[model samples]
Structure formats: structure tokens, C-alpha cells
Target: MKISARNRLKGKVVDIVKGATTAHVRIDIGNGVIVTSSITNEAVDELGLKIGADAYAVVKASDVMVAVD
Candidate 1:
């Protein structure tokens, strides 16, 4: 699917921290970089997101910013 988030980071799942109802997902964006985000447990479970899996990081337009310097 096409997303509007400009900072699209494709990475491998490195860690999955579980919460009461949500999951703190950590992905390895290569070059020794990692990104973390919160997602519903159901969503992650439904998508079967696990360590070593490939996934994309999507951020909404309202959640992103591009500053002109």
C-alpha cells in the first residue's frame, strides 16, 4: 500500500516488548539504528510480527514534519 509518511523506514524486527494491551515494537533500521513504536497487541498478533521479520514504519502526515533549513 502507498503511504504518505515521508520517513519510511524498512527494517527487521529486533525486539517486541509486550504491554498490557499494546506492544512496544523495536525494529532495526540498519546501520545500527533502531526505531520503536507502540501498536495494539491485537494488531501485532494479527500481523504476526516477530523478531527477524521484515516490516515498514508508517507515520501519518499529521505526525510528521518537514522543516526547510
Candidate 2:
């Protein structure tokens, strides 16, 4: 599928935590680095995401903020 996002990291689905309306999907890119994304449960089912499934973490954000105290 064609996408507008450029930051696409290929990885494998490691874990999935479902909530009432949202779900956390974790993907292991490499070297013990994992990225978690919170999306709707319906999206999870539509994508057929499951453990050991290969997928891409499509990162398309305008700004990423980091704060430390």
C-alpha cells in the first residue's frame, strides 16, 4: 500500500494490550528497541495485528516534545 508518511520502520508485533476503546500495539524494530502506538481497537482488528506478525510503525507526527524535570 502507498502511504504519505516517510518514517516507516519495519518490525514485528511483540505485544498487544486492549482497552475499552483503545489498544496499545508494540513493535520491535531491532536491538531491543520497541515502539508502542495507541490506536482504536477496531483498527487493530482491521489490520489483523497479532503476535509475531510483521508490520511497519508508520510515524507521521508534526512535532515531538520531550520534557524532563
The top-ranked prediction according to lDDT is 2
Question: Residue 7 in model 2: shift from native, Å?
Answer: 0.7
On a 0 to 1 TM-score scale, where does candidate 1 land against the true structure? 0.81
For residues 1-69, could you state the per-residue lDDT of candidate 1 as single tens digits? 776567778999998988999899998989998988899989899989989999877777688768896
Give each model's clash number: 0, 0
In model 1, the runs with Cα more than 4 Å from the true position are 65-69
Cα lDDT listed for each candidate: 0.87, 0.92
Q: In candidate 1, which residue pairs clash?
A: none
lDDT value for model 1: 0.87
- Compute each candidate's TM-score over C-alphas: 0.81, 0.86
Q: Point out the worst 10-residue segment of candidate 1 by lDDT.
A: 1-10
